[model samples]
Target chain A: MNPKPDKKIPALYGGIIMGLISAIPFVNIINCLCCTGILLGGFLAVMFYKNNFTPGTPPFTAGDCLAVGALAGIVGAVVDTVLSLMFLAIFGDVTQQYILDLIRNMDIQVPEEFYELFEEAMRQEMAGFAIIMNFFFALILDVLFGLLGGLIGYSVFKPKGQQPLQPSPPPFMPQAS
Target chain B: MLLRFFSPTFLIDTVVMKASFPYIVLVCLAFIWCIAPVLPPMLAWHVSPANPLSSQLYTWFSHICHQVDSRSLHLFGMKLSVCARCSGIYVGFFLGVVLSPFLSRRVSLSAIKWWALALLPMLIDIALDVLGIHSSTIVTRVATGVVFGVNAAFILTPLIEESLEKFIPMNWGQRKQGVFYESQTR
Candidate 1:
């Protein structure tokens, strides 16, 4: 009766959660943990669905894990971008001021020309256009990294006895059967 | 009143030592030690008015750091041990973990296939750069680095998880021992 297959809802939720986490300041390196979070979340969702919906049956497959991974990666990327921006906006000026002050206190002998160039660059960077421009580039890098992480998460933390078999079965399996 | 909430959080932190230790190790090895050792020689080589080791240091760093002029911190003069993209990835990894519980919990490293899609972008970029069809820009270098870095995390996370899981008492120990014993007996 429940043959209409779908893991979309859980996948989306899992993805969003993962994405938001990836956006966090320090904890995001758990991305170093790669898709571990997404896979775990997807597994949690499917397990929850199974436990709550049906008593003792596991309805997980490698493909399900893969799907969850993709979703989480996307969500994580989006969250990370927003978080970086929020942090940048909040702290960027303060950080710049501190750095400039520290340099001055140390009495570092910076050449006049390079100092001018550096100040100009910083000013441009802080300007509306430059920050936005860098953000766009950063977004691309982030998404690709997140996606790769998600895919790897699927590979590593896939549920026991569940994962899309990357290598196809040999041609003669039917004959043996 | 004080004991009510603080105890549980304290206990949770105490129990999560395994989870936190690696990061502590990473902080020491990846950032603290890493930044100091490579920087001095690099700086002395690059910007100083009269420096003897500049050429040697530049050549040495060339193998390790992409050393593209733009994404570098120009002090007395000379790029850091790594390029901007490489630095970004490492620095990102180093700095992006302040909210580990909320952020770490949201994503799982295992759900990703980091290495699977990497071949094409890596190959095309490196080959083209070598062939000189187009110059390797900072953006392109970063793109490649991100791909590789993500893939690296995929490989590393499982090793960490497996190690962590081992600290907990799970019934699989008997089974693991049995398999090992059987193989040795055979």
Candidate 2:
């Protein structure tokens, strides 16, 4: 039986979850672990999809993982863009200053122009560029991480072995006395 | 969780896609790991400020690492792309790859737990620092990072090998050669 369960909804849910998590300020710290947060989103999507699907259909494949991950990543990128804009608008200078302060505490020396460009973006003079950059980053990162997560999730949750299709009840046969 | 590493059906799938070889990819990643740390210092030494590559690497890594100068190793009087901890992690990954051959030829899923265990000290160190119980310095950070990184290497190398090695295509008519391989192993 073709188990054509809709993969889109699950992927959408995953993308939104990842985007929201990545957008938050302090909470984003969880991502310090190799973007595992975004990867989880992808894994969860496949889990959700698998849960909803009936058994006795073609088992899920890596190609399926790629599709779901790509969808989620694309959606997550858009959601992330909107959230970044919102955060920038709301926090404005405080957020800018915080990042600048962190950068200043570091010991590295950089060309003066690089600092100027970063400042320009933080000040919103380069708002459009910043948004575009964030969009691309999220899009790329989510897709790659999502696929990897999907692989991990599949391994974790995959059924041990397809229960041998319940042996068809012994074919009803009339036994001669 | 580690049991997930060696699922038989997963191996079957790996045999089919036959994309890039895992060992080759690992080697490439190892190269990148080595070079990523070295790039910043090298750029500072030779590349002009006007060069986009010089600026690009700094900007990209800034988002990922704190890149604190005092906490990073210097090459040619320049800071690394990441802080000392990150540098150790990458270098550790290289060591992990080298060390993996000595540990096991088959994918040993149980080793994953050890990798997580190795990471605990770093987490504890960071937590204590954040709570103001104690502050960590470059030495503490890099040392903890090395422990975690070394174990992480063992976990990752086998994973990459198991998940990806079978993807290398066989000579023509070699599809399903796995059935024969499976029987032989049995």
Candidate 3:
């Protein structure tokens, strides 16, 4: 059997899905539910990997899922950061305006100082330090959550009717005669 | 008296403790995770010098949560590191972990369905707010979050435990491969 298919393709597929969901404005709200979008990406990666298995291949294991999930997470984090930068370049911080409008519509009474701090932070969001920090944190969270998703995927997608290989019976021997 | 050390009871006790090491570690990590969010607000309120640390935590959590001020619970005049919904989830998760010992250890694939069912309330709450059918209050968010979290803890903990049992012993390089695989098969 072909050595369990290369993980890169599955990881890339999962990463792209994660990045798009996370970077898109409005669509990203799904992540607010415990980073569900990222988790879904990891789960999909494992699912894709499981599809690669064929008869006589090494049986799927939890470790394989974990490694693929983590790789996808790393790729996802990079994709997310790049796409976020692209969006900022094109839309010019629309997310900041969106938040401000949301707060106003909700009639929340935030302090004047808070507004100043928020605006200041938004302005600095494009800076090198902030971008690096964001990537760093995103990487950590994505990897952790992705690992969890992989484990869940394993539980759900484990192969059926696959039993452990029993040891061969002791060789037949004739009694001394 | 020395023979007592080799007794079945003593041997079983030793094996059990070794097996439980990973579970204990997981519980400790969960406790830390649950408590981390509370520290930011408490530190901001009580220790002026710790403001930087508190700010760091808020920043760290910001990625995972929206952290809308009005939607969050306030402690010591400062908003929590995460929103009330997230807070409820964490608290509920901790409670679930603590209580999981009393729950059934046999978690089947069907537990996933129950976990999904638990998320229904939260989804409905979000959908209502988004559709302008009804504005979800803080109580609704927290309540739904708690339900989801508890179910998540129940479903995921056993899976994690089972996986760890399969792998952790291998890391120690002690158990024979045939014996290990045989145990897993059983």
Query: Whose DockQ is greatest here?
Result: 3
Identify the candidate with maximal lDDT.
Answer: 3
For every model in order, the TM-score on chain A comes to 0.49, 0.74, 0.86
**What C-alpha lDDT, on a 0 to 100 scale, does residue B22 get in candidate 2?**
54
State the lDDT of candidate 3 residue by residue for B71-111, as single tens digits: 99888888888898998888877776655554534334354
Docking class of 1: incorrect
Q: Could you tell me the C-alpha RMSD of candidate 2 in Å?
A: 11.9
TM-score of 2: 0.68
Better of 1 and 2 by DockQ: 2
Give candidate 3 regions above 4 Å deviation: A101-115, A162-177, B1-19, B106-111, B128-135, B165-167, B170-186
- Per-residue lDDT of candidate 2, residues A1-177 (tens digit): 876678899899988887887777765655655565787788788888778766666776555655676687777778767886777678764555777777788997877897788777667623677668767777777787686666555555556563211111111222344
Report model 1's TM-score to 2 decimal places.
0.36
Instruction: Order the numbered candidates by TM-score, best leading.
Output: 3, 2, 1
Q: In candidate 1, what are the lDDT values of residues B87-123, reduced to their tens digit?
A: 5445444343322322333444333433455435656
- Comparing candidate 1 with candidate 2, which one achieves the higher lDDT? 2
Superposition error at B147 for model 3 (Å):
2.3
Q: Which candidate's TM-score is highest?
A: 3
Interface root-mean-square deviation, each candidate: 18.1, 17.3, 13.1
Question: What docking grade does candidate 3 earn?
Answer: incorrect
